[model samples]
Target: MGNANCVFCGCIEQASVGVVEKWGRFDRLAEPGLNFFNPFAGECLSGILSTRISSLDVKIETKTKDNVFVHLVCSIQYRVIRQNADDAFYELQNPKEQIQAYVFDVVRAHVPKMNLDELFEQKDEV
Candidate 1:
C-alpha cells in the first residue's frame, strides 16, 4: 500500500502553480516541476493554477440613447499574481460569471446614455 500511495504524484508545468491541500483544506502553492504529496497522510494536489496571462472576451448587447441596438465585444486580459495565488484560488468560485455581471452593469449603465457616435468615439473611456 505504501508504493500504491506514490501514484498520486503530480507534474506541474512551467508558468503554472499547484494548489496543495491538507485534509481537504488549502495548504500551500507548489512551484513548477515535479511535486510529491502523500494522500495516505491526507495531503493532495487540489488544483493547478496558471501564472501566465489569460484573456476573456465578453459580448455585450445594449441600446444607445437613440435606441439603436449595438453589440460590443470586450476583451479583458488578466494574470494571476504569484504572490496572491491563494487568494486567486479561494476568493471567487465563479470569477467569469462575476466578471460578466460587472461588465454588463457598466456597459448597460453607460451605453444607454450615449449616442451612437459618442459611444464609438469614447468607447475606450467607457
Candidate 2:
C-alpha cells in the first residue's frame, strides 16, 4: 500500500472503514466496498479501521497483602464506534497500548489491598 501510482483501487472488507487522505491530510472515509481514488491528485488510502468487536488479554503482575506475587490475566473486549471512527483512526496512535495502561493502573491499585485468599475466592468475579 505504500507504493503509489496514478490510480489506486482497493476493497475494504465488511465491518471495516477506510481512512482516506488528500495532500497528506484527512479527506474522507470510505465505507466497506470497492473504492477508487486518484493518488496523482494527492489522494491516498491512509489506513483501514475495523468497526467490529475485538478482544485482547492484558496480563499484569501485582503483589497481594501476603506479599505473594500474583499474575493476572484480564480479557478486554473493545471496538471502534461507528460514530467515532475518525477519532479512533486519528486520536489513537496505539489503542491497545492505551487500554493496557489503563487496565494495569486499575488492577495495580486494587490488588495490593486484597489478600491471596480473597483474590482466589473472587477469581471468577475478577
Kindly give the number of clashing pairs for every candidate: 0, 0
- lDDT by residue (tens digit), candidate 2, 5-98: 3348889899999888888777888889999988878888888889999998999999998899999999999999866887888888899999
lDDT of each candidate versus the true structure: 0.83, 0.85
Give the number of the best model, judged by TM-score: 1
The residue ranges of model 2 lying beyond 4 angstroms of the native Cα positions read 1-8
Candidate 1 Cα outliers beyond 4 Å, as residue runs:
1-8
**Predicted candidate 1 versus true structure: per-residue lDDT over 10-121, tens digit per residue:** 8889999988877777788889999888888788777778999988899999999999999999888878898898888878777778888898998899999999999999
* Alpha-carbon RMSD to native, per candidate: 4.2, 2.7
Scored by lDDT, model 2 comes in at 0.85
